[model samples]
Target: MKLVQFWRNGRPALGLQTERGVVDAAAEATRLGVTVPEDMAAAIALPAGELERLLTPLLQDPQCFTGAPLAPVVTGTDRIFCIGLNYRQHAKECGLPIPPAPVLFNKFSNALAAHGDCVKLIPDYKKYDYEAELVSVIGKPARNVSEEDALDYVFGYTCGNDLSTRDLQFARGGQWVLSKTFDGFAPVGPCLVPAGELDPNHLDISSTVNGEVRQSSNTSDMIFPLAQIIADLSHHFTLMPGDLIFTGTPQGVMHGYPADQKSWLKPGDWVEVTIQGIGTLRTTFC
Candidate 1:
């Protein structure tokens, strides 16, 4: 199922993507005299049967559709873990060796930005780059999960952009969080797809800047596959529902370019990240 979170009456409301448009789940539930979870996080936290029960009505409805005014795929998530240099070509582009383990990093809740939102350029920095990634949304609590079972804990997937400032990221004492966690830095969504519905292993993912293709690659290029990332992460701490994991980006980032060829994101530049199955996530830097 493709689920979306969007604004209605100025508050976040749940949606289901369909042929006509987005099915406003909350609105349909109200009309059907049925009660369902109010938001994505709550729906994800529900038991499997209950979650299915709640979605059945919306999934079968012939109406209740509206144009998308989307919100972040998962709002108020507990943790937003990110992996660095997980693509062999990206690692080579950065001139770094393949790591012995998954290189984990993080972005805070403040960084969460929705599809179609504006990503404001940090005036203090000159080099802002975009990393198009596939995000895993945890469905249940998991601890020390095995690689075979890691995917079972996933609720779904969302397209993500790991926006970063190169100066603070590389030249300033290796402060990744400082460089990546600015307000509206982590832009994700359009909609989230159930884990069972899509193959994370081989999706085509790419990014464009001002209508020009900048990064193009497939998920098959990932150094540490999705399951391994989940397994490794669970070994260290509990993975909670609503937690997000940005699996990593492939080659062709601005940072990988030579000095003269580098073209960082600037104000008025429209950026879009597209992943197969999941739609495009568009952001305008302002």
Candidate 2:
């Protein structure tokens, strides 16, 4: 089921996308006096099969929602785990050798913006770059998970842009935090598709900047696939529901271009990150 959040009468509510029209889950539940999940987190945490069945009647109603509007699937994510150099091509583009393990990094929740939200270009950094990645959403508590079963803990997937400030990223000691976690840097969620719907190995993922394709590849090329990433990460800390893990980007970032030919993202530049079977996440720079 394609789940979303949309505004109904100026209040944020959950939606279940169906053939008739998007079902305003929260609205219908309230009208029926049925208990509605408190927030997106709770809604997702609810036993999906049972919850879906309970809401099926309302979900089939055409008048359950107002006009379809924008809403992020969930708000206030607890953690944003980002992987770096997990794609062999992306590693080579930066003139670096393939890593021995998944290169892990992080972005604060402050970096998250919904699809259609504007990413503010930090005026000082003219060399902004985009990295299209597959974002994994954790659905259950996980600690010390094995690579074999790690994927079982995942809830779904989404598309993300790991927007980077190249200068700050490479300058000084090359710490990625300041360069990559600028406010509104991560725009996700046209939809968060259930993992059951996709095969992580063969999906097509692409990134387009201002209508021009800049990055295109398949998950088959990932150096550290989802299961390994989950297992490795779990060895250190517990992976909780609502924590988003960006699996890493493919090659063709602007920073990978020849120095003389490089061009950074500017105001009004639009970016779309599309993962086959998942959904496209589009955002504009301000």
Candidate 3:
């Protein structure tokens, strides 16, 4: 089942994207006199198969919802962790050695942006770039889990663009957090697919600027897959439901290109990040 969050009655509400349409889970539950989780976070915490059981009735209904604006697929997450150079090709392009372990960074909740939202670019930064990524959403609390069993704790996966300002990122002794956590920098969604439904490490991921493709590669290129990332992270900090892990991006970022061939993103550019099985997430630069 595809899960989504949408604005209704001036607030974020849980939604289920089905063949019929995006159903307002809360509204449907109320109409049917059934109880259900209120939002994505609550839904994620539901016992195994419970969410599906509760929403099955709503999915069978014929009614379809339309005209509501989408919110970020996952919200109120305690931590937003990102992996750097997890893609071998990306690291090769940048001429950096592949890290021995997953390199971690972070973004705050303020960086979250929904599908179709317009992202405002900082006027002073001229090296804005897009990194198409596969995001793993944790479903349950996991601490000191082994790599073999890491994926069992995943709630689902979604498409994400790790929008960055190369100038800020590599300047002043490397201000990674400041460069990466800008408001609207992490645009994720379109919809979230339960982990059981898709293979996170084998999906095709790509990014397009305007109408042209920029990054095109598969998750198979990842140097450290999602399972390892989860296990590695769980060893240090407990992985909680709703916490997002951006598994890094493939090659083809503008920063990876030769100086003479580089073309940075600017105002009026529309960016889309697509991951196989999930969907495309669109963001406009203004």
Give the top-scoring candidate (lDDT): 3
Model 2 lDDT per residue over 153-240, tens place: 8888888889999989989999698888999888787777777778787889999988999999999999999999999999999999
Candidate 3 local Cα displacement, residue 234, angstroms? 0.7
| 1 or 2, greater by lDDT | 1
lDDT of 3 by residue, 1-286 (tens): 8999998776677998876778888778888889988889888989989988988888876364756999999988758999999999999999999999999999999999999999999798899999999999999999999999999999999999999999999999999889999999999898999889999888999889987999999999999999999999999989899999999999999999999999999999999999999989999999
Would you list the C-alpha lDDT of every candidate in the order shown? 0.91, 0.83, 0.91
Which residues of candidate 2, in runs, are more than 4 Å off?
A: 7-12, 18-21, 31-34
TM-score for candidate 2, residues paired by index:
0.92
Q: Best candidate, TM-score-wise?
A: 3
Q: What is residue 286's positional error in candidate 3, in angstroms?
A: 0.8
Give one digit per residue, the lDDT tens place, for model 1 in 1-286. Answer: 7888998777778888887788888778888888887889888988766877778877775478877588898997749999999998999999999998999999999999999999889698999999999999999999999999999999999999999999888875788988999999999997899888898999999999999999899999999999999999999999999999999999999999999999999999988999999989999989
- Write the candidate numbers in order of decreasing lDDT: 3, 1, 2
How many backbone collisions does model 1 have? 0
The better-scoring model by lDDT among 2 and 3 is 3
lDDT of 2: 0.83
Q: What is the lDDT of candidate 1?
A: 0.91
